[model samples]
Target: MHNISKNNEKPEYGWFVKDLIVAFSIIGFIGIIFVSLGIFLTDLLQLFFIFAGIFIIVLFLWPGLGMAVMNIILDWKDDDITDSFDEMKRLEIPIILDIGCGTGRTAMKIVKALENGGHLYGIDIYNKMAISGNDLERVRKNAQLEGVAEKTTFQYGTATEIPFEDESFDIVNVSSVLHEIHDREDQKKAIKEIYRVLKPSGTVYIGEWNSRSAQLIGYMGIFCFVFKPSKYWEYLLKESNLTLMNVEEKGGFVLFTAQK
Candidate 1:
């Protein structure tokens, strides 16, 4: 574990994993080339289908490629990748946990969203294979930059083994973090841990790639598809100790909410 601090360079709160984005982008580019070749080689009707396939492939692999247009048409009513805490605001929750909080991107946002005072705890493993900008020092600096350092605390922890006591938080969030665990049983174990740490009636929220769209038909979907994510999470949430509240999918990602 390490302490967070401000630095000379600007702090980056990136949402996309840089390595995955690059790998998928290169594959998407190659796919486009092949599809373009087939466009000219096939009938006009076939050409239309080829173009459609290419478009979806690009959107799936390239993060935020044409997201501006998507933003204009789709109403993502929730704040940037957050809805659980937004709900908590209505209840004036005092203690919150952002499990797998990478670089305080969502953690800082959670702090700002609080009109009522709430202390936010963020935990993550800040090692070499951690997400793009996942560093304890960086998260600390980011919290400082966002002016929420006092409202938030950064710590070292893993999803399968959270460092908090039972029923420790009123609200808990685990976003785009579980699928990173390759083992299916371990993923379920992590969800169980989420349930273990929530107070009775406390809310637990999770967001992840569901691979339900055209992304599933392309190379970019390979990573998330391997996990059978939607099915496992659905089964676990319904069968676990929590009451499933709401579930929705958008922009190739899914959000799930439950109450303990």
Candidate 2:
């Protein structure tokens, strides 16, 4: 694992605490709506509000269920997300950059894979999501706990305008982040930015949620399904100068590889 920065800072778990607060606020708001209108209606709206509050509580209490369902609908794999890259075993030491690397799940894998050592940089635009939902700080703490503290750097930034220099990285990986962007132009800009920061012939790995029927409905599904089929891996090559390498389609994800 490339500890891209030298700060040796502990991973932060403060984001989860914020999630708790937001969850409570959602429940409270729903309660107020229900109480203010329950007596005027046939109880349909009241029941709906009550159910919404219950679901929010469930999300707070058992976030794993929500997160798992998210993975399933988004076709995001909890295990083996980067298993295809195992073949890179014999290559020279490669600098790996992970975009929107939530909680550092795949980042940890890259750390263990590169013994000769390289750089690991993670960027996320939403600090609350990165802190609470992803616990990226905790991931930094784990790296430190495991003595790889010298190899990782985490930053707060956006994908469309990565703060790194051009042609700096040997490999760049993005997992389960495209859909959340919700803008075709921005998504394209981000992809181009990834290519810009990569060295010539450098590899770019992208794993994203495939279109699943269940994902087309529900709130969580709506969240992940915002990015359509075209703006993803398939048309990226057509829109840019990168060379397509391979694509792996799993139940809910499409893992795409390309070279710049």
Candidate 3:
């Protein structure tokens, strides 16, 4: 007769080592409280035990959990490349424009990624935020450090009136900047300018507000009901000359990429 072994017991340690350390720390804390109240411990021993336990717990917990969080923060700080650029690279290294390029994250990222010769231009409406808040100088410094500063240029300009001839850029990307403007007419005009300046078959990308949390959704619902339908942006893009390529709704932001 063959006997079956029960493997049902949760292995006390594997994936959640940090959680285990935290749990142990909590238990140790409670135990320390009992010892202090009941046993009448001396001040030195009490302090030593409490500190040592806390230190040990943090030591065990920090590596995995802390490293994961650090990696996420670093990724957020770095430039992101969407898969749509694959075709852009395959065809030619086209001149790229970043509208509302606060601190030049996307602009820097694209410039660094390009091979051979390609020009990059960035424009921002807010002078202070574009230069100071976005760490534009840092981007410039990095570009110079990487020997690509000559290929990049930045200007203070509004998206509605881009200082360029028609059909100027091969690709334009605007990230996380629409809802803040709050002027529908100006927003439409800005988009039209983007379309006008983009060469035929060029790509335009827009990332904008896609959600309001449950707490804020009530306000959004009321505003939508009174003024416009839900997903007004989706319809706006439909009416534009560009063809929508993708809509990614994640991390409380929507990424919309289109081709002219």
Candidate 4:
């Protein structure tokens, strides 16, 4: 799956770092055995698994390191959020929806982006994700920590079918989650749902990977093979009855804002 969150993490069989650690452990152990048996000396393929093991180990132990590396590769900027919020101020008590809110990070960021008080709804398929803190209780606790729980509502749901009424929100933010849905049709449905839920003149901000070096893209591809992160426009095609507002590229990610 693509795992689009506002910017980043995954469930059982999903993004649990422990899974990577286990895979690395097994690969490393087997790699050592193969190397000692002279298999790697003749067959270089064994070396690939060994290095991959090391990379996974690094990723498991220090998640921040991975984000740091991505920043270097993508040229991350912090101002896109500021701009998004500035635009949101035009509405009164805007109802903001955050789709794919892994561990509530993107949801919290959206809460902070609001200059004035606004009701925020966060949705996620967190049942199987493996981020450091991803349980429903943890999300609730995080919202408490952020002091936005009263105004925020976290729900277990998928982007394909948002659980809300039509024209219920003034702003909808799908950060980094669209790419996680491997099926192109599902991605389009998610966008359609967002469009359906948005009121006329409402705004949407989709933050997802757009441009990146071949090496980096290949690297991420190994971890998330089903991801179709770049073909984002498929979800916001011109014929979708939505108006494209602004498109900005920030490093490896692109933020596309639109109006409905």
Candidate 5:
């Protein structure tokens, strides 16, 4: 097993931290400007400016800081993925596929949880904007550092056109990926591909953000509009002919477990 010494090295989750810092800086600058303007104004107008400045800062910073806490400090994604794995029935020598396996974050965790002998194949288009240094080589290196390289494989692939035979995977995992497909038609095609690649009675786990939830509104603010509601995913699963087995929600995220 390939392993990296745990001296000072750590997994890089991406530019989220840097992005949050930038956002905070901008918010602070704008807030300062508004407060400065209020000092020169008169009566109710001054009060309005001061309050509006504080409100704007709080409004956006609440979500931005919350995201930092959940993603960076708490590493909630790992916990959520592990919870999904715990729900699955044990399969001997399972053949697993991780869609949109960015930087091997989710894929490595899944492989580590496999007590039985099995291999995990991860595929991603490696969209750089999705995550800092998101590429096949980075994922492979991460697997090696995590000491799961021998049981894991990373490659370039898309959800709409999975480069594998029908019924190839015993289990499929999609985490916060389908929403990136954007177009509803392409999203449906991706679901169909997932269904096609699963063996009979195979299980699929899909994790997505619920746009309609209060958690999302609190954490993402107006940006939550980017995600679809949980009902949309249920409809997609039904449309793809996959039987929805269970739906789990936590921290504004939803996990849909289905069977093929």
Candidate 6:
């Protein structure tokens, strides 16, 4: 492995830190007001204010805490990728495409999994707010650090308009990326693009969060609104003319395996 000094390693803040900070700040402001009111009100009113404040804090804090536990402590993303890869049929010298491969996290993992002389192409919009250090240079550097530089290629690209020729790749992996495309029409366009670039009978793995799942409700609370139900993705795949082969749901996260 390519070794780097400890100080050179930058932390990745995936997608939700800003939202979490804003939410907690707003809740803290409201909590202060509630506490002030309790200081001046009658005993019964003060008790009600205290309980209300606690309830509000707990409710809002739950999502952030849950996310931290899942992403940090449990390493949910890594586990999810591993599980998905285990289910995939092995390919010899496969040409793989990884969409929205921020900082080479998923791309590096996939490249490393290839024992044959396979190559993985990773593309992303590199939105700064989506992932800390989410830039082409950062991903390139990560691929080098992970010792997969020769096996991987990183570039600036979008899902709707993938910068590649038709039938160029043998397999495609898209993890937690579709929801970032806010417009439903654009999401459909992206799926079509994936279909256009895939070789005949090529496989595609799409991972997404199910907004309606109870686990998602507990983890994301109101933030679950950011995701779509599993049915939405199934519809998109079918409409794009991809054959949906399997749907795996684990802890509110769904992985759809389809074929071109």
Best by TM-score: 5
The sequence of per-residue lDDT tens digits that candidate 5 reaches over residues 1-260 is: 22454774555556544465457657856776887899999999999999888777666665566565556643543463665665343787889999999887778878888887799999999887677778787887787778788999888899999989999999999998999999999999999999999999899999998999997777667667878999999898888889999898987789999999
> Cα lDDT for residue 12, model 4?
17
How far residue 49's Cα lies from its native spot in candidate 4, in Å, is 11
- TM-score for each of the candidates: 0.72, 0.67, 0.60, 0.71, 0.86, 0.84
- Residue 226, model 3: lDDT of 21
Q: Report per-prediction Cα RMSD to one decimal.
A: 6.4, 6.4, 15.7, 7.5, 3.1, 3.3
Error of 5 at 10 (Å): 2.8
Regions of model 2 farther than 4 Å from truth: 1-78, 86-88, 130-136, 213-224
* Tens digit per residue, CA lDDT, model 3, 17-132: 23433454455455545545544556787666666655543443333334334335434554365544664565456798888776555566677667776888887765442233
Name every residue pair that clashes in candidate 1. Answer: none
* Candidate 1: RMSD to truth: 6.4
Return the TM-score for candidate 1, rounded to 2 decimals: 0.72
lDDT by residue (tens digit), candidate 2, 98-159: 89876676777776777676778887775454345555556667667556667888777788
Q: Once superposed on the true structure, which residue ranges of model 4 sit more than 4 Å away at CA?
A: 1-18, 21-83, 218-225, 229-236
**Candidate order by TM-score, highest to lowest?**
5, 6, 1, 4, 2, 3
User: What tens-digit string does per-residue lDDT give for candidate 1 at 1-260?
Assistant: 12244555555665344555556566667657767776777688567657765775665544423332333333333346654445688766569999888877667767787887989999987644445666888898877767788899998999899999999989998887887787878878988898899988889888776665654333243443543556668887887878988887766667788888
Of models 3 and 5, which has the larger TM-score?
Answer: 5
Q: Which regions in candidate 3 have their CA more than 4 angstroms from the true location?
A: 1-79, 127-132, 135-139, 213-230
For residues 135-186, write the lDDT of model 4, one tens digit per residue: 6777776677666779898888788988899999999888777767867688
Q: Which number leads on lDDT?
A: 5
lDDT of 6 by residue, 32-65 (tens): 5786788788879999887777666556655656
Please estimate how well model 5 matches the true structure, expressed as its whole-model Cα lDDT. 0.81
Say which prediction, candidate 2 or candidate 4, comes out ahead on TM-score: 4
Model 5 sits at a Cα RMSD from the real structure of 3.1
